[model samples]
Target: MGHRSVADLMTPTAITVRRATTFKEVARLLKEFDITAVPVIDEAGHPVGVVSEADLLRPRPTGGAATAEQLMTSPAVTARLEWSVVRAARVMQRHGVKRLPVVDTDGRVAGVLSRSDLIQLFLRPDHAIREEILEDVLTRTLTLAPSAITVDVEDGLVTLSGTVPRPELLPVVKRLCHGVDGVVTVDSRLTCDSADRT
Candidate 1:
């Protein structure tokens, strides 16, 4: 199967606010859209920052109303739409963020990819995961014949048994198995001909 990209899972119609948007308006947008955060965009439609519910709750200065610019976390962390889902997830984890604004090639905000979107991969059925392994991973990715490997999946755990061409490639196969979305664990039981070290 093709690697899942940020654009594949992101919500393309991300709601955004201008830097000058008032705190009340931000709150309203959050509530109205049922989202935890929204990107603050510049006049050029690029993400300048992100204003989240937590940011809104931070103590405001004196009595003057604050805008998104004053409350937002600037230099927003963003993801490119073409990035693999794994890369996007890594960015979010590294930044300690729950969501990232996905930008286009031109650096314009296109959408948002949230933790929930990444989690959606784990919800795939066990059969689908199994089919992908047998049809895509083994057959296509590893270029192994259909009978060269036996695949079994139960509760997201995968078991691989049969003969592989090379022993050194066992780890590579395992890593590829892990790359399949919704795969929980992989147990490799493949054996190779001892003298076939090429």
Candidate 2:
């Protein structure tokens, strides 16, 4: 089976906001759309940054509002349309983000890829002899564990539960599950807390 591309699973034409947009307006957009974040774009329609729900929660100056440019995260890390799902997951993990902007060859925003999309890809049971396929796929892959992680396979859906050493490992573990056959979806409820301190 061929691996899926980020573009294949991305949300095309996601909601975006301009840098000059006010905090109040940004909040309204997020509330109206029920979204956590939105891309910040320039007049040229190029993504210059991103504003997230967390950014909005930051305490504003007394009697003063903020602009998207002040709250947006710049130098955005992005993924190419043709990049593999594994690569995209790695980037998301490394950046400690739940989503990534997918860009076209011309650096124009093509879509957005989220963990939810990746999970859905693994949640479909369309392959034959799924259990055997899953075993075959997992055996060839390297998995990280403290033996605290639990894996369950039912009707080709993989459910993972446990605590990882770091939040970053959560996405890595999810990506590993995606490599396994017959894994229609992975439901991960892994918590991240410091496991190593020296």
> What Cα-based lDDT does every candidate model obtain?
0.88, 0.74
For model 1, the local distance difference test gives: 0.88
All candidates: TM-score: 0.86, 0.63
lDDT, model 2, position 105: 89
Best by lDDT: 1
Among all windows of 10 consecutive residues in model 2, the one with the lowest summed lDDT is 133-142
lDDT per residue (tens digit) for residues 22-58 in model 1: 9899999999999999999999999999999899888
Q: Please report how far candidate 2 places residue 76 from its true position, in Å.
A: 1.2
lDDT of 2: 0.74
Worst 10 residues of 1 by lDDT: 56-65
Alpha carbon deviation, residue 98, candidate 2 (Å): 0.8
Off by over 4 Å in 2: 62-64, 126-198
Q: State how far residue 117 of model 2 sits from its true place (Å).
A: 1.3
The pairs that clash in candidate 1 are: none
